[model samples]
Target: MSQMNQPDLIGIADVAAKIPAFLNKIPNLLHGLKQAYLRTPNTPTGLGMAFEKAVLRNPDGNALLFEEQRYSYAHLNAWANQIAHFYLSLGAQKGDVVAVMIENRPELIATVIGLAKIGVTIALLNTSQVGKVLAHSINLVKPFAVIAGEECRVALDEIRHELAIAAGHFHWFADQDTQTDAGQAPEGFVNLAEKIDLFPKFNPSTTGSVQGKDGLFYIYTSGTTGLPKAVIFSNGRWTLAYGTYGHVLNLNQEDVMYCTLPLYHATGMVVCWCGVIAGSSALAIRRKFSTSSFWKDVKKFDASAIGYVGELCRYLMDAPPSEQEHGHRVTKMIGNGMRPNIWDKFKARFGIKEVLELYASSEGNVGFSNVFNFDNTVGFSPTPYAIIEFDKERNEPVRDTKGHCKRVKKGETGLLIGKITRRSPFDGYTDPEKNKSVIMTDVFTKGDAYFNTGDLVRDIGFRHAQFVDRLGDTFRWKGENVSTTEVENMLTEYDKIVEAVVYGVEIPNTNGRAGMAAITLQPGSELNEQDLKQMVSTFKQCLPAYAIPVFLRIQQQVETTGTFKYQKNQLKEQAFDPQKTDERLLVLLPNATEYCELTQEIFNNIQAYQYRF
Candidate 1:
């Protein structure tokens, strides 16, 4: 028998063990299908409607768990209604945008729900953003009102003059117990919490008129490429996400989802919260993610599921093993960016039964989920998508003579494009030009459009894909394309390395950028000569010559976005320049077995086009 046809006993045993889990997915799949079919297109399917439905089903059920406080579904709904009424009284109307800058708290959730109820689109501003970025994000949306928590008062105050909104429209709410009445309304801001008492705790009639196609959220991109772009998150897309996770994941009222991700991110706000609402379950939220507090919080809340980004999982693995890490109530985790290197290890260590590793972006129409508890794959996407051939040099899709993009064969890495259809429409960014730049016209035929995902993925068969790297992140070295994600994954497998952010750096007199990695060592670990040699040896054995990073920058920590995505733009720009950064630099010169220190002399030599990479 051919090796491909031969089934090993270990593989058979693993399959047998997963039989029950696979069988359980049937009912959930059917439920998802029913929900998808029943959703009324172009009609009102706002999150407010779903929240109301969830409240009706489980009025007394715990809806939100934040720090020491817990609010029931009815309680939360009433608070949302009160806020909705207050906003309505402020003359907030349908189709109006409201910029919201709040930390991850119950108030944030309540404010979002409240705004949705009043038919006001929310520009969910990142709490971490400040000065120019903050002002730019708010100005891009042009919101009529700006609502902020006391925690973000300083940031809002800093950019208040830059914003076009009136001073009276500025609102603030107190989240801290120490906050006084005088402190609540910082200078030009109104105290939103105080005004909530004047409004009735009843559902607003305006919510009924809100349609599925209406703007729901203006979620800003991670700003990995450049400035953050405001991406539209429509009610239809939100509802679809709700159905997929709630029904397909088989969440129930008994489940308590622990969400430590930022509330501004789509994963936390839409995916995590929508699932809780869809299943009428409880949500345990935190102000921010902390590795030390993660497991403890999970155990404290008796959480049955947790949300994660790849960095969170990595942070957990890097932390010292604790008694609290094991024997937790958590059985499932739902999120994206879980690397294959840490996948099995994270699951085994944490005692998690399922990891619903998903693949989706804020604005992209294509989405995938591992519904069958599959390992190392962003499982089946029902949406119409194509893995098309791309030109690495031009950084665009490869077009045929007919001017249509061609699809890649199975197991090939290619750019992912989602078909822009009526059912799965691409509700693009706030900037129309930015939207146009990503959409490929006549992709398959004349007049057809597809939303470019800006991600390169490997078709792993069965409609599944393994994320390779971002289109911009992949760089050419020695005339061979190198995947930054793939290189970083390999580097993290080394014992001494804790984290790695791989990028390409321009080399003097070189045809293309050379591979470079900024790595953080494990606590108390040092990159000695022996360690350096071992790293080189390991890379030689595991990766192709062209794929290996030519330079290594050792850092104390890796900078990440609020959502835990690695900040590579800065790293790429400041590559190996000793004058630009204080971090230690090491370089593997052509055919060198070990990495040598990149001193000022060597740096100058490389920059002056004296050395060839």
Candidate 2:
């Protein structure tokens, strides 16, 4: 729906005709603009402040919607206050961590706001994470207590036992029943619905309150490979996200934001919740994302906007052009990672007029939102954004003798880095050492520091930045980060597997990239599908769901450099098909656990839509 590139608009005559003249005039028009209108800074000081302001301004407005159930500003605030009072009764004080694990539900938002109101830090646990990984993530936060769903209670129980976290640490809320109101009362665990009625009346006070610099939440984001990193998200950053989406994007009160994505994700928390907090209605889906059901829900809810990552958009695009695609009330969308090739088609097909593409991080302070609703580019930001050339093989920037890092020229791809200063601070993880690892000091000169984004960006110029790819070995798969080293480590533990090199391979009709592993086995070891399946099952139990590899390759010996670095470029190019390379390859079929030899027939079927991932 945004501006289109010439080549991308070629098939659409109307769009193509306007491209040439538009391109020539756009740069000057943008350059001619003064700093007045476009110079808005990042989000405000705190999520609590934003919520208070919104509640005060629009107390009767609809705040959230789950199925047919709706919560107005008064209701949301009341529920949050009750939870805050309950936490206070439990000896919770400022800066105390309260872990929350739930799917997309009203309770999740209530608990977060409630905890924040009383200065309790919310630790967001990803629902997709289960078994050992989930347990590990919980332990990493070391929260005083966890507020989880009854549906999730079973998983949390399993995780609680595995991690040796105390059973009493859990506070469960039943999310399935909407008709049954569990009013504020002491139950087995606090019933979120019940707490609303019992919670004390709102008494706005600034004394003993959480502030801009205080921790708003802790989110465990995907690391390169291994356990996830618990990134500290301060209230200031949350305020910024709220301001960017609610004000900068100009979300109206009539807007209904349908949030099908998991609430723990950065996109959902900021893009989805921020809009709702600004007095717009929010439509939440409790179940897993289904492309077939997506349009139905949008129409049913009369959603005017939707939040997405690239994968979600592609799924919608693949669902045969339906009248419902453009028939819905949706006019605009805001999210990250829309691939350039499919950008125009996705926008037009969906009838989205403005794709407010953005670039940001859950832990980072610097972020960019498409206020101008530009195309291809993730728009632009007033913050300092730089793209510097990086050598993938060496895994370091190519610096000059003067020790100043060079920026990528226009249209060139490089590692993206953001200046880390007092104002644009990188308030990193709780672990100082872990924080130090991502921060690069003495970049341009002595004492200068920058936050390593760990992403590759292309400089399109004109103050615009385009997401090219991710740097290093970590790749995003289905909106989750898949660490190559973590996958390789899990694979190599198998007795038959001597070594493994993991990397992302381009898959047809997918978001980010699909994970594939090239493995070498011990001498004389036969590549058995049964054994491979067992290993994969072990991985499923031990690792997070997103970390599992989709494709596998068996080789006699992995190609490596003299410095013992695995050569992944060639392996990534080969992918999983047997015809692509002589190396024996196998893939985990659609619902099957065991891997099967990648035959040309099966491979073609996969490419031609015979198999569904």
Candidate 3:
């Protein structure tokens, strides 16, 4: 980390220069803040209300653009209305959860909004999930029915028997525009599109009856300990995001935002989409991110803004220069994980004027938005928060004699916690036990409680903080949280592996840690070439692509503590260094299908950023 490579410090004067622009937003910001807090448990306002307002304001405007397909606000709204009416006819009621697994497309958006209008909580299943992971998520909520697109039918069918919902309740929508092209529905699944074709295309009367306290979404997160846990994202909490980050982006009707991130994530589904509705702006989306197709899409859509995460930016930075990269209408970018190292570099390279880098979790109470356009910080949080001293070895926050968590000095790194109150409430995971683990009580007072973010951040001046790293068993890679326990469970499940320990290790010039696993073979098992490749295939099937380990080490036996916890800290320090350990190391380099021997030269190349993993 050389001084020349470091990002420029944001000074008081630099912040002062942005006051005029920020002041201009005070009117909308204040209104948004008011809307956020005032929408109480019983208030008849939520995502559906916000979206309907957008439609009223700009019915004919381009509301969505997916590749070559275009959808006006009126057209999209009608589709959602039809969905809501048809679901209501099926006896779908408020508080009844419905699991929907659709890839990034208009169908997904319409389904979410339609369900919300009728007060049906939608459980947005991650498109990447398959087998046990997918079944676990769907079963956890015990949804009334499961609605999946054609793209996800196979995965859903594989887990149908394991799901709590009955077989006949499954509904399927074709991947294409089902209204125009009604693809054949597979056996045992209802054709949702064809059934809803004649449904009235008007706002559901139930929209006005939907209360804020009612559940809106069940977003699943891979917990630090086990399989994914469903988080209760109530309509009341939805207002917090819609009113805050929504207004912060300040897009207009004419501005088009291009988003390539997965819609299942909060950043894409909530933050980015909220902003579009707030300003009646158009949002362009891709089925999946392809660096090769990014700039062309931006140019094609004439996007005024783009959505991103740190890893997406790194890919663009790593790509070779092209003519299409220059002279695009992408003046503003919004998202999170824009690290300090490439903060300015990305902006300059892409010619972006504003980067609304934000900090938030799917279920966390607090959030940080770069409203002031800070260069390297996650920006200031308006809600009550603390960056307290954390003891790494003990894995807890440091407490004083009076038993209050001590806050770190300004500009020092510490654990981030958000105070739970009426305004900033922790919706928490569906599992009450899991909720208990993250809620820290008696912090600075006997009755106070704070939601532990399980992340470390540096408290820069003026209430701003820079994200440092994730703590405990969870690590972020490729903008997705990789659960070490989950990965370890998958690895050890293999018959040839006796035991497995997983952790995250830093790679030079990467936004987050790359997954690494250390394992011991079975008594009779040998680390043969066939078995090594088989391990790769096993992981690909069991785990999401991002959760697959990029590095592996064959250990005599996994070291553990007296309490039987794996000594992951020691292995993390040793990492993939061939010189530090006598054991064999294997790597799944970028774009390589199989793991290969990590020779000294190969390790050097990785260190020098020759491999982009």
Cα misplacement distance, residue 324 of candidate 1 (Å): 0.4
Worst 10 residues of 1 by lDDT: 2-11
Ranking by TM-score: 3, 2, 1
Give one digit per residue, the lDDT tens place, for model 3 in 1-613.
4322334445587779989878977888887889998877889988898889999999999999986789999999999999999989989999999999999998898899999999999999999898888998998898999999999999888879888787778999998977679798989999988888989998989998888888999988877766888888988878888899988888889999899999988889888988899989998999999999899999999999888999999999889999999999888888999878888888888899888999999889989999998788888899999999998888889999999999887667899999999878898888888889899999999999999999999887678889888888888899898788889888876788888888899999998999999988988667887876888888888899999999999888766557344367778899999999999899999887788999999999989998888
Q: What would the per-residue lDDT of candidate 1 be over residues 433-544, giving only the tens digit for each residue?
A: 7788888888888898889888889776667788877666567554344567767777876899989888888776454568899999999989998987899988765455
Model 2: per-residue Cα lDDT at residue 300:
81
Give the per-residue Cα lDDT of candidate 3 at 4: 29
lDDT of each: 0.81, 0.72, 0.88
Candidate 2 — which residues are off by over 4 angstroms?
Answer: 1-45, 162-167, 178-198, 201-208, 279-286, 492-498, 520-529, 532-536, 557-562
Q: TM-score for model 3?
A: 0.97
Which of candidates 1 and 2 reaches a greater lDDT? 1
| Count of clashes in candidate 2 | 5
Runs in model 1 deviating more than 4 A are 1-20, 177-183, 222-225, 473-613
| Model 1 error, position 473 (Å) | 7.3
lDDT tens string, model 2, 1-613? 2333423221235445546644643443343232112322233346666677667777787777777678877777777777778777677887778889988877788778788887677889888777756777888877888887876777776656555445455676776543265533223364555544555757435313666667888987766646677888877666556655555445556778887777788788766777666544554554567888888888887888888888888777777766666678888787888887888888777788888899888777567766566688776676765778798877898798988788876667798888986557788986778788888877778988889988887666556677778777688988887768767777766778888888888777677778888788899888765786787787776566677888888877765566345457667767776776887778877778777777888888888877767
Compare the candidates by TM-score and give the number of the best one: 3
The residue pairs that clash in candidate 2, if any, are: 43-240, 182-194, 183-194, 184-194, 224-483
